[model samples]
Target: MEGDVWMKGYFRKRGARWSFTLDIGRDEKTGKRKQKTVSGFSTKKEAQAAAADLIAKFEQGQYVEPSKVTVNEFLGDYMSVHYRSSVRPGTLERAEHMLKNHITPAFGHAMMKNLKPLHFQRFYAEKSEAGLSPGTIKGMHTFLVTAMEMAVTWELLPNNPARRAKPPKQQQHTISVWSHEESEMFLQHAKGVSSYYLIFLVALYTGMRKGEILGLRWDDIDFEAKTIYVNQSLTYSLKELRISEPKTKSSKRAILTPVHVLQELKKHRLRQKEIKLKLGTGYDNALAEKYVFTTSKGNFIYPQVLNKALVKLCKELELSPIRFHDLRHTHATMLLSLGVNPKIVSERLGHTSIVITLDTYSHVLPAMQEEMVTNLETAISKIQTVL
Candidate 1:
């Protein structure tokens, strides 16, 4: 092609068949001119139509150069060049973990251009047969879809095959929450470990995520106003702790602190001060970082540490075991059960929308509905008796 004009491909008769040759472009890596040739067309018109279609695709920038790049190679390049710095460290870590453990193992050797929806369907079927949870399979599907989307964007593939594949349907599980009695019993047991009590209390009352609770700084708390400002979260990666922004815009919020919870926090601060004074220079200088929750030596608390502590406490108390996140759910459930407005509960839990709060805690609504019906019946009966 020259000066935005379509180049006419050469045609010839070869062994009673029509043949055509067209120059597409130069090799991206070697900078050599590349051409495509086809033979055995029954008629000249057939060869001409094929050549015209090819030229049109090239002109529209939709022509994908033939490539031997494997899915693994493309995924590695995509993660390194397109994904790594654009997302939070924790998200990047999860993506890398999923790619290494699941996606790369299954499809890495397959040529990028040869991947089809059936290949992905078979992969999902195998995973389902192997008893992988739908959630895990869905995560893998998301990662593959996103990677393939970038591949299409880079013109490494004609289109994203993952988009056409059917991923496993996400299975919703019942949201588990602690009853009032269970919450009280757990807190009673948690008090023995003074270091973790405040953390658990904050999670239970404020519904802050584990990372957000760990990320708290003394300056984020206002004792007189009984408000806690959540602006960041502490994330651990490669055994190093770093502060990151909250998970969503709503996660960056102010939570009204209960008076009793504030008192406990104040006492916890005094205890930390005494410990710091006793340790003197032996204290970890990192404690000066001013995280509200820390190790006995004054280092930032890790999520795993909190989880382990919660697990150990549950085992000791012989209570139903739940993840640390269950405390946040328990808080929302308790609030909604007490006739608290769903919007307020949504804001307290830092949900992006009331729809999420409703969907997540829909199991708790049946009881609320029953209560509403009973109240309506009672009001109507009182009016009828007056009449």
Candidate 2:
């Protein structure tokens, strides 16, 4: 059975189920009729009530068409169109990987408009039960909040369900850094055997990020002034390696280098030149931006390759294996222990704020506190003798 225009929308009974259709007016450009149909009500009264609310929204200019776009497809569009320009390649890559492996498998097939806060709440609970870290869950929550906000703005959904959902509490892990003796042992052991010696030295001495070190060009290093310019980062994006700007405004800084580190840098440059001469025109290093570090084939080195190399070298030297990033932490920890000003350390590490540097390194700075106490007591004793 079917009925015409019950409460400004058509109604029909198909077998035991009731359905409704609303006229959404005509398309201006095409002068064509437009309509929307929603079905699966248990009673004719229920279909009638649902259509009335939809009509009210349509009149108020607050109505959005229920789209067939699945969460997976919409998110794909969102990342490519919205996130491509806003985020770096490495960030985009990780986000996409997380979406593919963790998120999409849960509710990607569901209709985008039908997503509810409960769906996401269950997702977090399930992920937590599966032993995922709270910080990681928090990251996923952040991504959903942003993506769904964009959906609301684009009128793909009327509101952001993710904004109402709660994720697990955030958790942080202790940062690890090398001791001075271990740093010396590694450097001494690596100097003789490792091809990545200069790279490791640059990380420990400059406190630069792995991406920053990999992205360095020879011209960025000023041998005379003993300075290193951090301009860009080497990152992977869309299946290709590329260089992008630094992580933040402060990350692009010029670090003053020690004479010894610069001396080793000069030796590294000479070696690069000799390799270029041997490769002749076959060298990709002949490019305008001459990279400070590269593979024997003259191609830029991948970041993961460097991580693997560091791990293998640590095992060979019989030292506790640490991430390549931990070397930068080692540099900051060592300097703080030597009575270097916190502000100076912050600037050298290219932290956006000095507070970040202080908070991050405070756990490893007990020696610095002891040294400060001793100096303060000595100064008070000297003043007392004068009095």
Candidate 3:
């Protein structure tokens, strides 16, 4: 009875109780003739106020369908808008796989309004129990949290529930590296193997990553200067080698090789020249680009293929088994054991900063404490004599 736009309200005959409701009608700014409505207001003043509020909200672009969005939908939109173009193709593919295989299937259809922190906590527990490593589960949580942050920006949700979710605590673990004896034995075995042996040597000496090594070209090598340029990384897609710029600007620079490594490289270059001459017309066109290393067929050596070769070598040598990547750790460990400054090691490794180098190699350099004490003692002796 309040107004035509108002719907019927509740009233008690004996107690004089009153209830109010609002009737909302949408207004189209243009001539599309579209309209929307919601009803039930008891008082005329209340109805008018509700109408004004709705108009202002709609004008301010505050109206949103709370039920229209699902977790999957939002994640998809966010990936398309924010992440699709920003990451590498491999990275994008991995993200998609993670979302589809682990994240989206579980919560993809869940309504944005109903998601809660406990749901994610349960998810973390389940994933951990299922044998997923803490590091990988942590990555999943990170992706979820980032996606929820986008939700907040979009005003689809009031807050990020994922922020409150407690992920499993990560455990610190160290991987084993080659001892000096083992390292020497491995190098001895690699002698006369091929220029391919030089790959592992460079990895152990320079701490360069496998991708960076595979990406190296003759132009990047300065034999006279005893330096190697690291401006790119090689990746594979659709069964083809693709050379992409390094992941970071810090990764793009020159690193000096040891005198011994330079000598080995000189030998390698000569061997490569002979192979090129022997192949004649059968040599690959790709090999003409001056890549420093390649397969016998003159194709870029894939990282996986190199890893398999390392595994085979490790097995034959009866060495304490480790991943191909552990060679980099071996290099850092040897350097730090010799009391090398962490700053110098970090620069050679092309780490973005010294902190990363220290964090990674600190465990391998436990002798640093003794070295520091010795230096301090020497300094104190000098000071006492001066006094």
How many steric overlaps are in each model, in order?
Answer: 0, 0, 6
**Relative to the unseen true structure, what is the C-alpha lDDT of residue 345 in candidate 1, on a scale of 0 to 100?**
97
Alpha-carbon RMSD, candidate 3? 5.5
User: What is the C-alpha local distance difference test score of candidate 2?
Assistant: 0.89
lDDT against the true structure, per candidate, is 0.86, 0.89, 0.78
Q: What is the C-alpha RMSD of each candidate to the true structure, in Å?
A: 4.5, 5.2, 5.5
Candidate 2: list runs displaced more than 4 Å: 1-70, 111-113, 155-159, 285-289
**Reference-based TM-score, model 1:** 0.84
lDDT of 2 by residue, 178-272 (tens): 89999989998889998999899989989999989999998898888899999999986788889999999999899999898999988987888
Model 1: which residue pairs collide?
A: none
How well does each candidate superpose onto the true structure, as a TM-score?
Answer: 0.84, 0.78, 0.81
lDDT of 3 by residue, 157-209 (tens): 76789999988888876867998889878888877563468998889888888
Model 1, CA-based lDDT: 0.86
Q: How far is candidate 1 from the true structure (C-alpha RMSD, Å)?
A: 4.5
Candidate 2: minimum summed lDDT over ten consecutive residues — where?
A: 280-289
> Candidate 1 residues 1-387, lDDT tens each?
111223555877767788787887789999998778878888888987988888888888778875689988888899889999788887888888887777788888999878999999999999899899889888888878888898888889888899899888987887778998999999988898646988899999989999999889999999988999999999997557889999988899999999989999888888888988899887775664487888888887778988899989999999999998999999999999998999999998899999999999998899999989999999999999999
Runs in model 3 with CA error above 4 Å? 1-67, 237-240, 382-387
